[model samples]
Target: MSNLLWLVPVLPFAGFLILALAGKHVSRVWVAIIGAGSVSLSAIIVLMIGIGFLLHPPATGNYSQTLWTWMQVAGFNPKITLFLDALSLVFVFVITFIGALIHIYSVSFMTGDKDYSRFFACMNLFVFSMLLLVLADNLLLLYLGWEGVGLCSYLLIGFWYESEVNGYAARKAFIITRIGDTAMAIGLFVIFYQFGTLAIPDILAKAPVLWQQGASIATITALLLLAGGVGKSAQLPLQTWLPDAMAGPSPVSALIHAATMVTAGVYLIARMHVIFQLSPIAQMIIAVIGAATLFIAGFSALTQYDIKRVLAYSTISQIGYMFLALGVGAWTAAIFHFMIHAFFKALLFLAAGAVIEALHHEHNMFKMGGLKNKLPVIFWTFLIGSASLAALPLISAGFYSKDQILWYAWASEGGNPWLWFIALLGAFITAVYTTRMMIVVFWGEAKTEIGHHPGKLMTVPLIILAFFSLFAGFIELPHNFGHFRLFSDLLHHVLPETVLKAGMDAELQFQLLALLSTFGGIYLAYVFYYKQPQRIEKLRQSGFVMNLYLFWFSGWGFDKLYNVLFVRPVVFIANINKNDVVDKLYQGVTFVTIRLYRSLSFTQSGSLRWYVMGLVIGAIIILSIQIML
Candidate 1:
């Protein structure tokens, strides 16, 4: 099983290579099969291995396979290795499983796309990179996967090359993420400098020893790691790129935003939980940032007109909840939430994509109404997804995971009452916006013609994901209700058990709180959007609120803020250096030399006699100087 782990990533990479190298000549059906089949095969491999691990658990609760010695120096060596433990197993399952479904859905979603081959190629490459990221044994290998995924993201986001706006969005996503990648690289260097190793396990082993020296260094390193996570996860100041990322095809959005790329940050933090455990300050910082970002993104999702943008903001906000879970020392719960979120979020995005495709690329929610009847499969699947995302009590997967996070936030040792309060508020807002989006898009009167119905290929994945979204949470119900701890118990072997533990009564409080927030938000959404749908117009009528709404709709003006703060300044500096510095200095030097040569041309006089006289004089002077020397 260990040796076979490489095959999981290898199959997708091979598919990418084949499609890229010979796609133009290949039939579209073969291309679709190759693209989706590779991932499906990998998912099967992952499932078999996961089942193997579950049945015959490793004594150490970890497994590793070393392919080769990646690098070696006197005292340092990093191997090309893959680690399959509980945490990485979860990631592998999500990447290949959700990734495969998205690939399948893309077949129909992108049927007539000019760059269908190119799109699948990029998707395959992304799956390979994401798998490599999770399965990597060392930080360097992980970074390689990291950059690989980033490259694929840029390519896929700009897959429709004819669209200038898509190109711009791709560039923006790449550049913004590179900023955090740079910081993450620096943090990796810091890790190597202090520990003399780049292997994750080795660094983790040494993290405590380094932390024993001082809290300051631990906090700094942790913060730097958090910066990288923030950029990748689309958290807070670095989140602007995610909303704009909707320029890509819907499956790409589902793949990147919901299932794979953006989740890289959460995976990174979770993978490095050993180092994070040493820094309470860093953990607190994570909690605060997560709480703040959840609300920020939740509010932003409320005002989005574009259907994908609403989902995009919802992804960011949901990730914020995951980070909040990690911040409050609920590692297993965070991973649990991430898995459940992937299923439903991908389902919603893909369903929205089908609607967009059916409406001839109409993405505005106002243009869509009464789609429930026109696209029944999409309507039902999307409802399940939205209900899960809105965390509608015991039936929704999100409810279980989110409740655990909130429980830990309030009950954990370092958990703050204030942070928990903000998180609950965000949850309420999430339910409201999600319900608002669903009602406005699917329930109202049909405002536009449905150009076509989504084919079976697209709807099948939606049904599967919707099923998971509705029931995946049962794997991690709180211990209070029959003391079920299957998920936590499985994770304990891989993750260091945090000291903070929720009692039965505390768990019950969390369930009640989650239920209230979920129901309250849903009711509020109903009253506002269903009962008094006209009230939405009234809210839009107020200039101040409308402006605020517009700001949120535009991702809280973060795109403009980033341009002003980073992009514009960089462009300004480049222009100044190009025009004022390099051009003037280089051209001035060349001009002066040319002028000096021209001035000396007078000595030639363009006459044979004068040239001979000058030569003779110059020779005499040179001879005299040589003689003196």
Candidate 2:
């Protein structure tokens, strides 16, 4: 089973190569087969490997397959190896499994696209890169995969190159993520310098021996890595890129948001858990960033009129929850939420795609009312996804996973009441925005005629994801409710169990508080957006309230702040330096060269006499120089 580990990532790479080279000559059916089939095959292999590992656990609690040496220089030998453990296993499963579903959904969603093959090619590459990122045995290989996804994102986001807006979004995603990537690269450099190797296991084993818990190097490295994760995951300061990323096709949005790019940061922080543990300061920063980000993004989600952008903001907020869990040392809980998030977020995006398609590409929720019966499959699935997103009590998988995070936020040894409060507040805002989205999109008066119903290719994926949205949490129930720990148990070998503060046993109270926040937010949204729409209008009439709404709608002015701080200065510099000193030097060289050329041209004069005279003069000058020497 370990020997077959190489096939997991290879399959998708092969699919990408085929789609890139021969897809244009193939039919759509074959394109779909090659595109979705590759990831599906990887999913099957992952399932078999997972079962085998469960039945016959490795002594070292991990399986490493070395395909070849990636590089060897100065005692730095990193192999092209695949590392599979409970952690990578979970991520690989999500990437390949949910990735396959999104690809299938894309086959139908992108039906009339002129660049259908190109879309699949990029999608296949995206999956392959993400798989590599999770499975790589060394940081260098992981970085390769990291930048691979970034590049693929740019390609897919700008797939509709005809739209300048889409192009801008793609560039924004690429450039913004690069900031964190740079920090991560520097962190890798520090790690290699300290440990003399890039192998993850070697680094993890050596970090503790080389540096104490509060060592400066350890803290710096951890914070650097966190910066990288922040940028890739679209956490604060870098989060503005994600909402605009919705300019891509729906499945692209689903794959990037739910299964691939945004989750990369979570995986990075989890994979480097040892470093974070060594730096309490860095860990606290992670917590604070997560708490602030979730609150800010949740508020922003409430103001979005575009359905995808709302979900986009929700993704940011949800990832913030994952960060919060990680910050509070709830490692398993963070991953648990990640798995559940993938299930439902993907469902919501796919269902939204169906609704958008049914309404002829309408994106504004206000313009898309009364879709309930017209698109019954989509309405139900979207409702299920929204319920999970809102963390509606026992029925939704989100409730269990989110409940665990909330519990650990205050109960863990590192946890505090303030982090818990912010996270809880975030939960309320999440439910409010989710409820608002549901009501505004599906429960109002009919505003647009249905364009067409979605085909089975699109709807089936939504149904499958919707199923997980409701039941995946059962694998990790709360202590007060069945105390199921299957998910955490599987991860115990890879990640440490979170420690609870001494004498803290208020899990039940925390759960109830989370439940109330969910229900309260839902009821409030229902009343304001559904039952009494006029209330929103009256609130809008208030000057300060409208200003606040506008602020949140503009992503809390992060973009504007960035424009003033970063964009304006850069543009100003470029405008001022249109013909800078360096250009003047080159221009001067050109001017001198042109003058010399004209002077030499006068000697030619397009005549035999002029040519003879020039040759004689050149010979005389050369002879005189030789004489002088």
Tens-place lDDT per residue, model 2, 1-629, is: 88899999999899999999999999988998999999999999999999998899899999998899987787878899999999999999899889989988998999899888899999999999999999999999999999999999999989998999999999999999999999999999999889888899988999999999889999999999999999999998799999999999999999998899999999999999999999999998898899889999999999999999999999999999999999989999999999999999999999998998898899999998998878888899999999999999999999999998988889897799999999999999999999999888888898989988999999999999999999998999887777568888899878897877643257877888898999999999989999898999999999999999999999999999999999999999999898999999999999999999999876666889878887899999999999999
Supply the global lDDT for candidate 2. Answer: 0.92
Steric clash pairs (candidate 1): none
* Model 2 stretches astray by more than 4 angstroms: 502-505, 603-629
Residue pairs in clash, model 2: none
Computed on alpha carbons, the lDDT of every model, listed in order, comes to: 0.89, 0.92
lDDT at residue 325 of model 2 (Cα atoms) = 91
My TM-score estimates for the predictions, one after another, are 0.93, 0.96
Error of 1 at 144 (Å): 0.5
- Superpose all Cα atoms of candidate 1 onto the true structure and report the RMSD in Å to 1 decimal: 3.5
